[model samples]
Target: MFANIIILILVLLALIFSISKWRIHPFIALILSAIVLGTTLGLGGESTISVVLQGFSETLKWIAVIIILGAFIGEVLRETGGAFRISNRIVKWVGEKKLPWAMGFTGYIVSIPVFVDVAYILLQPVVESLSFKSKRPVLYLGLSLAAGLTVAHTLIPPTPGPLAVASLLGVEMGRMLIINLIVATFAMIGGILWVIFFLKNSWIDYDKKLQDIYKEEQTTTHNELPKGNWLLDIMPIIVPIVLISTGSFVTDNLSGWVGDALGFMSIPLIAVYIGAFIAVFQIAKKDKKNKVNRLVEQAITKSALVIMITGAGGALGFVIKASGIQNEIVQIFSDFPFLGAMLPFVVAAILTTATGSITVSLVGTASMLGPIIDNFPMSPEIVAAIIGCGAFCVFHVNSSFFWLLNRLHEVPPKVLYKTFTAQSLIMGLSGLIGVLILVLFGV
Candidate 1:
């Protein structure tokens, strides 16, 4: 027992050092850790190899298609200017005084199928325009938009982080979507509140510095922006969420062909594929066949690295389970099962702080916790949500998104810390609260 505990500690320390200090790829780190753990735990060469392969293959079987399809949809949304249209139209509706609220909601919607960083960039112009006109601080709007985008980007699927964790933990896609939307909505609200209280007072002179610097670039990009229809822009994203939710509801309440059809549609892979098909037709450059093909290729190439990382995570998870470390830990902590619920949140927060990559945090923490949580009494879906919340926490100088916001707005460091970083912390804590409520009510 003592030996197993020591091996587990060593594996974790090595993982953190390799990824954070040595800058090793997570795929390599996870795979190496799995081999080392297996050897240390007395799993022979043949058994270790077999376990790793099985874990990797099984996890890919569930998530590979969904991840690729989701990425393709995101890529198309990104390249087509549809994502920009969605945010621009929505921001226009709410008008100036409520600019922060509108941008927050826009980011929430836009980020479902687009990366948060991409969403931030796509929506930055609208934010800048609003801030310029209203003379409101850009950080207010930037943090608002980022807050909404961050929660959905981390918690919800079709986004890679939560999707990978959900798949590895065997959470059904429909259920994952439904629960996360509820949890993420609350988390987003928390973020919006933070923006109002913390950032509303901080002001930057957009007309003097930012306007002179960015005016030309903004005008040129606005003219070149793709002119796509709004309905077509959102249909691909909305349809899947609706179909998946409806299918989940129907499968539970009804029967016969209708239920069976809903069940088929609700399958995450098929639902996402259907959305992808819809999105492909709305390509911003539909006339350029070569460009469209290239976009698809780009998405595929991007997804390949994510697929390998997720598979490697599964390999490490399988080895952990096989080593019986999970059982020993669970027994040791038997009196505090609630800690099991909180474990993912704490570990993911630490990893994200260390690595500055939410995907790395999600995949790595989920890989470490997935096996043990599988044996826990609560739902794995909830555990995945907890991990997602943790991954969304505390973005600082180390985060890429932090730098992007700084470059775009040039907010003072103190305001950036209080606003952007504080809002993220609010979102994460709010999500943890939501999870606690669910656990308390015995969900």
Candidate 2:
């Protein structure tokens, strides 16, 4: 027992160090960690290989489909000028004085169906336009948008990270979604206030380097398609959420009807795919030339990469669970009187900080804590919220989201480390406090 505990701790530390300090890819690092964990725990070479392969296979089943469909939907939206139409309509409705708030709202809504990085990329031109017109630092508008999107992407369900955690822990999606929306809203407000407070008066002189990049981005125009109605543009994004939420409610409350007519009608994952199909047809039919083939090809290509990455993270989590290391760790943590309640959050934060992959953190933490929750008198909803909160605590060089911000907004490495990193830390800690309070109240 003692030996296994030591090995587990060592494996975790090594995984973190390799990714954070040595700059190793998380996919490589996770596989290596699985091998070391299996070997140290007395799983033979063949067994370890089998375990890893099985893990990968199991994760790819559902994750790959969801990610691919989600990505395809996002790509179609971007190419069809759906995102631009939505942003422009939003800005016009809210007016320039309230554009920051509008951008924040847009980020929160759009990011539900789109990946964080892709959503940011889609809205970059809009933000740039606002900055140019306002003659203010682009970082202010960019960060506001980023905060909204990141909070929802990290904390909300139906997105891969939070959904993975909730699924592993057997938490109901409806409950998780309720908690996620509440916490995410608070986190977004905190982030927006932080950005506005700091960047409101700060003058960022437009450097020649940035100007050149901006000019280049402006010139790279694709085919000009007709501007779709704002309602049509926004529906593709909202349909998935409505479907998933409805499905979750029915499945949880009306289990007898799950596969029955009403229950079959409510399956969220199915809703997402159906929504994707609708989005493709709607966007493609509007185009005059080779619409069907072009839309299908674009959707397939765009979704493939994200789906692979998500599946890889899932496979890594499965290996960890199958190794028995997570079970042992849970037992050890559960024995502690005070630490047991806090174990999920702490483990999640540590894993997230180390792997720089929220998906990995969710899988690792949820896998380890699953048994603990079953044995203890705690709400799985609280456990899910804690894990979600911990996943955003630290954003550093290892995190791709950090780099996305730096590259997209032309933020210097130093500024990113100072400002964006600080904002994440604050958001994370505040979330932790919220979780801790819930735990304290035995909620």
Best by lDDT: 1
Those runs of model 1 whose alpha carbons end farther than 4 Å from true positions after fitting are 204-208, 213-225, 284-288, 411-415
Could you give candidate 1's per-residue lDDT for residues 106-168 as a string of tens digits?
A: 888888777778778877777777666666777778888887888878987877788788867
Residue 52, model 1: Cα distance from true site in angstroms: 2.2
Candidate 1's displacement at residue 45, Å, is 2.7
**TM-score for candidate 1:** 0.92
List RMSD in Å for every model shown.
2.7, 4.0
Number of residue pairs clashing in candidate 2, backbone atoms closer than 3 angstroms, sequence gap of 3 or more or interchain: 1
For residues 1-443, could you state the per-residue lDDT of candidate 2 as single tens digits?
Answer: 77887877788788778877888766777678877777778888888878777766765666556666766677777777887777777777887787677888888877876788889988887777676666557777887888888877887755777766765677776667777777777777777788878877544544333455455335322113355776887776777776666665665566454446545544556767776767765565455356656655775676665445445555555556666665666666666756766677788889877777776777767755664466544688877887777877677877888898777765777887767777777777677666666666756
